[model samples]
Target: MTPYGSFSFFLILAVLLAPTVILGLQGKRFHTYNMVVSIVALGIIFASSLTQAIALIIFTIWQVVLIKAYITYRKKSNANTIFYLAVILSILPLILSKLLPFLSVVNVIGFLGISYLTFKGTQLIIETRDGLIKKNLPLSRLLYFILFFPTISSGPIDRYRRFNKDFELEISGEQYKLLLYDGINKIFRGFLYKYIIGYSINHYFIANLRFIAHSHFEHHLYYMYAYSLYLFFDFAGYSAFAIGVSYIMGIKSPENFNKPFLSRNIKDFWNRWHMSLSFWFRDYVYMRFVFWMTKKKWIKNRNLLSNLGYILLFLLMGVWHGLEIQYIIYGVYHALLMIAYNSFERFNKKRKWWPQNKLTHVVAIIITFHVICFGFYIFSGQLFHKGV
Candidate 1:
């Protein structure tokens, strides 16, 4: 089980009803549910470790600061570089913690949901800064939006605007029942995916590196693909858990994946795989790069620079995975494959003899899957070790 399993979840369930539960007994309308929830959450966080407690405090302050700044900016009809800096400041810990682990003695930087919360919080601030959205949420709703226990771990990475839109509705009986059942189903499904599927494959099917060291290319290649599938199921299972839990809380998070294996090309696979991360990069990084490149007239051909931009973007994507040399190689490897494939497509667009049918699609999928699998070996750091 994950560290924040049953006890943490039931604690949240109790906290969710603290307002009504307390009022029904004592007959008062004090909005002290947040205090109750925060106290319980703080206790759990402290019991878990100091790292989580610090993270919780940081995120709680983050939500408050962003909400205040956004509201103030909206009222004044002005921009604040200070607010943008504050957003960056809030994100700095996630970056340092995730990246600096490669150099640390104690690899103890596991603060659950820090990555997801930072993404969601920064995007909220960005939209607010752009005047594309407003900040009118009440304290309770804003607290719920940011610190809702379900999606706080690994996330489907919902945008602030979509989440905020559904904030006001009362949690109904039917909704609660449906959500609870769905959450339970998701938990079971995630366990199956992680343990039954991933553990079995990792333990037995994939050959050890000692075997690979002496084996032929084909043997190593097959294990590589199996390892890749294990990664997908592991990550996808966690995403399912996050999204399913959100559903039970009466919120619909964006799906984090599609049937990524069915994709016909590298680009298509990225679209299907880690959908939330891909979109976040597109919205925050790629589009901004395109716009800036277009305006500066640095390159006469937009397509040329756009492709280069993608390679650079994926370099950052690689670093986001980790600060290891393997991760950098993984990033560069995919970028080159993507670039070459795109270039090939552009070149073949003029040739009538080039295969462009289902057989061709199947071949591309197989090849791309291999390419991704090779990259996963780099991600693993150690090949086929136990519980990798």
Candidate 2:
């Protein structure tokens, strides 16, 4: 069954409400029913779907390890190394399942959300290390975050520090009703985007890309455009659905999209499209890379070094999308374009050759859109192999 199917949705709702009801009735003091709820939810997830099972496992292990590492490293200053190692080890199963699909059974290439949940887990570990805030690692918060179900499949990728702040707020009846209705409406709209728009494009406009890949010329470009459009609706739809569901549960998830297609530049596009994921990489991946480079004294000039660092970071970002060579190519291609754009902007600040006119903005927008479409050839995975 799909993660967001009717049965799964109701089951998750019941599971979430169980502990809240129990705790509310038990004099409002902290009750251990949250752990029991988590255990039961884990069982349901494991029995219901393989992807859900993997997600539950990852979440559970992550929570437990975070608590253990904090206890161990609280006294030692270099405890961050241990935490980092644990984080890598926790992500190992997800990485393997994704990169080694051949090793999977019954075509389970990856879990429902190892990609999204991996970010949550990594961010928690890093936040704990940075001393931004300390989570008590209690069962209630763990259950709410991990088995929250709304964001389990897809995510808006909330920050741990902010997430904890939101989670601790008391839920009221009025708030619950508002969240539930808003979430349902969002889910309906997401379905319209995916099933109506994305599916239509895939069926009528593009059809099976494998067939187009084997066919004659001229059709290839058409397939690329259709596929790009399809990808946008499909993924954006998923993100919307996830965020909406989270809202119903009294959680204000970060917005993941902001009219990315209307972006006039690559930087603007990154800021708009999949905003949560981009920011995750920016804060956790790109910034960390810069810190490492600076610490090593690898490049003396911080500005130039940071620019170069972004390029290398995106190259890895590409590979992380998939183990395929084409994904890497796609990442590097975008990274180079971004670096060039940044450099040109910096240089233009010193020269008056460019005009700040609407026509110039329009031209730049067109150029940026075309540049993005060209990289889709590498992203589609068919470009690297002649056969389907």
Candidate 3:
């Protein structure tokens, strides 16, 4: 029943698109078809199990109510208590879901899309408080945005304002055709990434690595390289499928990855890899930290403030991955890398002797790729596995 992993899923998706195609071509506007298709798609996903369905329903409703209420009150006065309470209440379900599992507790609140859904809701709440999302949107639209099944599980997280524009658009025949072309192209590419190449790399290389480690096989370090590429293709494949599906439905969702392997440094890699999440953290967390410190006159050194911001950003990123030690280390590793890169750039800025040619860029990319592969090893959590 999950997306992008099964033939049955695509068959179901195609079948579900009947209503959308009909309503879309009738000049009934985007919302008419968009709402219908979104509901049918979400209904299909949520209908598989009662527990997840209930959890998702409860979570969505809770956030909507909280957000709407907060918006109303925020118009009168924006108190810290109200804002924090609303934000905490909004994330309570996801917190419980994430924490309960780590405690060896029965995961009552857990659902497949809970993390992404909660992130969307929390963004809505924070942006609303900041007066960015000013309108008290319709409940149906809000639900559609949160439970937008195309990206419900994992995301190239969409912004409320950006999505609203597409929701309001009525596509021309030319535009619709272009959307179709791009959608199908991305979907085919996703097939290559996830089903073909991704599968081959995983089942052939990574699977064998486990056996090799236990056996007398040598040169086992190749497993790390294989795992890293497999990861890129596998998750990038899923993201491509998700984004492609969104396009077919008329939402130009932001991209997740952008030639990440070609990046020249940790700073450049973050900008390219899992771009939506990175950008989200950058704008909301990292930038905010810098702004807060700058506002309070806490530190006058611009470079120091920026470096500290990177630490805060990556630490939050690590914690968000989970409260695991390896994840924390992964975050610290990137933070330190970014800081060191920043310092290097500052030191090199005064020197006319530093290379500024394609050769230097190529060398930087090579070095950056290895560094990222090592980070991926930590992220893989294999180092901490008891059997390993």
> Lowest summed lDDT over 10 consecutive residues: which window, candidate 1?
22-31
Off by over 4 Å in 1: 1-46, 74-87, 99-110, 169-185, 207-219, 352-355, 383-388
Query: Highest lDDT among the candidates is held by which one?
Result: 3
Considering lDDT, where higher is better, how would the candidates rank from best to worst? 3, 2, 1
By TM-score, the best candidate is 3
TM-scores, all candidates, are: 0.80, 0.82, 0.94
lDDT of each: 0.69, 0.69, 0.84
* Sort order, TM-score high to low: 3, 2, 1
Predicted candidate 2 versus true structure: per-residue lDDT over 101-150, tens digit per residue: 54444435356666776777677667667776453566557555655555
Q: Which stretches of candidate 3 lie over 4 Å from their true place?
A: 22-30, 210-220
List all candidate RMSDs to the true structure: 5.0, 4.4, 2.1
Displacement of the residue 366 alpha carbon in candidate 1, Å: 1.7
